[model samples]
Target: MAKKDYYQILGITKSAEEREIKKAYKKLAMKYHPDRNQGDKTAENKFKEIKEAYEILINEEKRTAYDQYGHAAFENGHSNNTYSTFTSSSDFSDIFGDVFGDIFGGNRTKRAKKGSDLCYKMEILLEEAVKGTKKEIHIPTLQKCKKCHGSGASIGTKPYSCSTCNSKGQIHIRKGFFTVQQSCPTCQGRGTIIKHPCNGCHGQGRVETYKTLLVKIPPGIDDNDRIRLNNEGEAGSNGAQSGDLYVQISVKKHPIFEREENNLYCEVPINFTMAALGGEIEVPTLDGRVKLKIPCETQSGKLFRIRGRGVRSMQNRNQGDLLCRVVVETPVNLNEQQKNLLHELGKSFNDFRGENNSPRSKRFFDGVKRFFDDLTR
Candidate 1:
């Protein structure tokens, strides 16, 4: 059989980024996983193909070599020949465990359970997102019990081996034709049982507590961006390591400016006189006010970009620009003298629909006239 295209197998384009590739792999892997599609030979083969493609594509070096030479890149050591072989142990839980959960728990963790990652949604001002800021957050989570020292046993006592699986933490189950080794039901895969439970954590080993952490918000952080704090999540089970805490950011909308990617956009209103004759106006920036000059006969909604005035990018360290859109404000609620002055100025033009005074209006009227004339014909 001819080897399938890796990008085609993952249902992603050639230009798909690493994150996109991972996302596509996770979705397909969850569907055709061996545990999910057991006894289905077609699904199993498809899953093997998917895994091979993912392994090659997810790595920077492998992906580059694959892109350059296709299947020949890994001809020497690639496991494409091992489609029938599969491994029982995997680190898939670190990424997709929270998503699939226990329902699709194909790759079960044989070791003690690690702490669950926690997500904290924090709303910050746009200014704070642009410039760096510090925040102190309090979260109620499970911590290792001080009384039992995270062992789940009382200060004086300790846990003993479970007799169900002979301290192996796993049991063999004969399912139809094959004997499958699975986690022991009696000990719940911990390999040990707590006879004398601690009064502080009551055998679970973790206690409820509130923790205060000072998180440093990085500059140029955008909305929906997350910052990870190591070992700041819930306490693990059976002395496993604690998981990480993800600080999800939500930037509050600014009154004067809106951010798009790295750039900032704001609408600046200019009077008809200022727009027609040209003048200097002050525009608001994150730091302070800056003067922007309006050119003569500047049209409404024209963008004026001020380079290096927007938020600095966190990744590339390149400065962004600030774009100001000018909108001409029509004169309203004028006095008699002002109205008379405007009427005289308006009369100065021979025809309002002519190209000299209003070129846009003249073209618009001409188009309208052509449309009606065509209709009449």
Candidate 2:
């Protein structure tokens, strides 16, 4: 097989920074990953190709040699290929852990456990989200034990280091010719053992309790926006810092308005008479009711802009406009006198076919007539 340009394989320029190279590598790696593709030979080969390109480009010395001597730099006894040991048999888990720790999470090896983060989904009214408000939330969580002081040891005593792994919290096992790292079975990866455990929390060093927090929601916060409260999550093992609490915001649907990127949209229904004769009507706004002028012979679905009446932007601090779409509503439930008045009014429209009175209908009918005329011909 012919050698391909490493930069071109990763779709990056030769001067691309390390961060840029990693970014491109991650995006392509995820798509062509062997596990995701499963039994597809092409994707497996592509993943191998991407992995090979990345390993060469990510190393500084190898990258410099490649830049100077190209693919020939990695030939026998070359500076770029200095490793003497067999590397093709290295565990895939270790390689992916080193690469995807930044993209996904940390390594697969067991280490010390810490406090787990917590997430709270909060639903707020549209008005409150637009104007900003404070909310009090209560959650059940784990807090560091007052009795143990997070040491997990009984009074007047301290935890002793594990003898199995020598307080390293991990053990290495030789499988055939490969070495695999695993948590110390004696201490469960805590690197220490409490012989005299605290009576209050047994040996966990944390107690379950209820907590109340006052979350101040910012104005113009959109749905799915999260607020992070540090150290509000479950207490860490043995007094480690607590994980964070994430408050996910979800805005309730408004009865009269819908929001879109700082803009407020509303449908205003006007009676046909009010639309034809032109009049002022009251429309509800976030602040209060405002007057809207319906022009004479106003058509349905006409949009009117009320500037600066919408939500203010959180990013740029600029206010958006309120867009009111007027929908001409037909009158219903007519009395005898009203029915008679409408009948007379209808008759006055020249049997409801006058071009001047119903210009849109006239044009529509004219188009329909021409369409049929052409079809017949």
Candidate 3:
């Protein structure tokens, strides 16, 4: 049978853009790759077909010719056979270097790679988060070598232009009927070579050192917050731009409080007497101790909201509220006299049960009775 249409196999129209072509090719290649399919003959054939199709489509000139003349253009030798071109890995480096230069400022191929970014994780107390604080950190990183001043060469000498590429840092290779441009082997892709290397950094231009920086943690900053300091990263070779430093913030666990967004939650233990006869109590807050009133006959797990007592967000002026959950504490380690007094109190509340007793408990027991009665029926 005749071969399937290449465009149809890759699922694209002739008018597809470069990105679309690459996307389609990558999908098909991954699906039928020889390494993935192993002994599957059909998959192997499909892989080769797609590879050939992509090779033609990715090259503008060859793609145009294939579209106009079909496969006959290659058989008749009427078009340039760019698909048969063989390029060295170095050549690919130069092409990417030029492309990266246009996309990100300056040619990366011509300069030493920038140092990697560094992250410093810091833990701050809840009080510190409420009112911003500054901290100093020491980090080890690669800095520009002072001896050679980032040149990677002796003090009196500089790198010389590579002769292989005539300082262009690229070379054209011809294979079969095609030509592909790649980097020059002699100078890699930097176009220059060091004649006398620096002794301090061994020609790398950067050295390992420890650096100190002052990081400011903003107020209201929450856990896992990140702050970035630009150009504070490791030094780049040949005096290229340095990397960046990132400070990650983590809030230490509070002894008496839990944080959620801008809000604060705390559990306050109230004595049984306080729950029985409501009174004022002191609660701890970031600012200071604040007075909170407890109503008479208050029960455990009662939440009290304190407005404007939580956090003030860095971005907004509105402050958050503090939530206090009350837990009635039972008297513990009581003496004989205390036990007798409690027993008298219990006798006084003996008639507090049933309909006139705790109304909530009575209602809950009534619900349970109705539920079991329905189940039995």
Best by lDDT: 1
Off by over 4 Å in 2: 1-111
Q: What does candidate 1 score on TM?
A: 0.69
Higher-lDDT candidate of 1 and 3: 1
lDDT of 3 at 237: 69
Q: Quick one: how many clashes does candidate 2 have?
A: 0
Which pairs clash (backbone N, Cα, C closer than 3 Å) in model 1? none
Candidate 1 residue spans exceeding 4 A from truth: 1-111, 172-185
Task: List model 3 lDDT by residue over 231-326, tens digit each.
Answer: 898887687878899888988999999998889999999998899899999999898999999999899999999999998988876799899999
Model 2: residue 296 alpha-carbon error in angstroms: 0.8
- Model-by-model lDDT, in order? 0.84, 0.84, 0.79
Clashes of 1: 0
**TM of each candidate vs. truth:** 0.69, 0.71, 0.69
Full-model lDDT, candidate 2: 0.84
User: Candidate 3: where are CA atoms >4 Å away?
Assistant: 1-108, 168-184
